[model samples]
Target: MSSETKSPTPSAGLKSNLPSTTTFITGHNAEGKAIVLDSRPATWKSFENGVMGFNQIYTNPFPPDLNGDADLHFHDDKIASGNLGLAVKNGTVCRMVDFGPGYVCMMHRTQSLDFGIVVEGKIDLVLDDGSSTHMKRGDIAVQRATMHSWRNPSTTDWARMLFVLQDARPLFVDGVRFGEDYGRGTEGLPRSGNDD
Candidate 1:
């Protein structure tokens, strides 16, 4: 059982109260035997000047080719290269995000379907139309391709959420195509190739 561990380090000017998240990858060994491949903590990348941290847990292209462990090698390469982006153009990505106390993310839109699940603390999901919904632990927000943002309402504790994003068909409303809008959170992250 091969393992790769990365200890979580708090970013400068921010201290997160959330614990580290560990991920386990399973695969088949030689002779067609199932086995645990890798188990380790997902590496976190600080963003918004330490107001937020993101960890890419796993990603794979749509219609994944699992034969011969090709997908496993692909994921390994992505981790080694450290080029995992916010969303995959023709794939799916699972990510975990930590929000600092009272941090409000910029209003942005992605051309993908997202399942955002609140894992810790409380958060407010704000929409472009000025409507907000308070989500507590175990609440899930199925975010379609829309303009939205996340706000951590607690001023003394951090919040965490897990998001599963899948590439979606181009979204058009009133003949206006809305692509990816990273807003103020574009630093150190690559576009998901859905931009218009």
Candidate 2:
């Protein structure tokens, strides 16, 4: 057959379904109303498509005096170091993360230890003792198993955070219980806005 004599039929259809992907419902609004699933919640498999999620679980029990709000968010798709799920190796683990604008996250515990570092943007860490810390870029705090909450102060900006969580333990330390109290160890330590 001549080179130009024949041609294959051209396929015509939607070539990409990425941007138009379906949203999966997983939560609700602050008013206890049905929440539209804006995006998929972060899971171990989230790293597969260069898109991870870290959002407030609106389905869980709402914190006292508060409604459903996702002040903290995390988007981590790249594996910075080690193999996938490497965190389970040491029996103790740490995770560093980056949050985009409209991002917020936690660094304290109601049931476990939480730690965080703010490399950019502003955030507020609220403690169970009615005390709170307002942190800006380059600030960090570690929670040794204390009840706490995380909030984002900016309306248009996203805060990037580096979180380090330790494996759960029966006790905060020998003879020291972190079950229902924390943040009192900061009497001598500089707090947020300390410029440290």
Candidate 3:
């Protein structure tokens, strides 16, 4: 495996071969019950800057040989390959996303309510109003009707986090969400074209 795939595993208060003190969450959730997810520390300090473990996966819509760092990063950030997403509701979703080491998203506006939980590392978030704030692990912030962008004021360390967002007017292909190519028009979801 490549170095990118060789990430340290936060297990039982230890990483790689280093001995440390920490807590790892291990549990599941039932449909009708309130799920209080636990994200125990991998040690006294095991922050991915912002990267959380949400069962990351990648899907290549082309030939398989396009597996490299540059390609992977593009897929991870743009195509959202490395990012793992969990559906919270029809208009809300959860994802483990990376902001960066020197991450820049050129200012943009998003009409959504974002509730972020810092899982690892740190972030210096810049809002549309030019307001900024620093966020660290275990910290949570709420962004409402805000035009904003994210930055990791660090040079050597990247930022990661668990983001829970509710789309104000999220685009949908059919009766679905994000990446409107799923279940909708031609080459879309497997719908019978019936307006229910």
Candidate 3: regions farther than 4 A off: 1-90, 169-196
Q: What is the C-alpha lDDT profile of model 1 across 1-196, one tens digit per residue?
A: 4755456544444457687778877788777787777776657777767888887787888878888777777767776786766778788888899999999998998999999999999999999999999999999999998899999999899999999999999988999988888887477677787554
Best by lDDT: 1
- TM-score of decoy 2: 0.40
Give the per-residue lDDT digits (tens) of candidate 2, residues 2-51. Answer: 11222322212212112221224444555767645354322222221222
lDDT of 3: 0.44
List the RMSD of every prediction in angstroms.
2.3, 19.8, 13.9
What's the CA RMSD of model 2 in angstroms? 19.8
Per-residue alpha-carbon lDDT of candidate 3 for residues 62-180, written as tens digits (9 for 90 to 100): 23233233434443453333232222122344455555466654444334566878766787778757888898988888865455566767776756666665544554446754331
Each candidate's TM vs. the true structure? Answer: 0.89, 0.40, 0.43
Q: What is the Cα-based lDDT of residue 85 in candidate 1?
A: 67
Give the alpha-carbon lDDT of every model.
0.83, 0.41, 0.44
- Lowest lDDT block of 10, candidate 1: 5-14
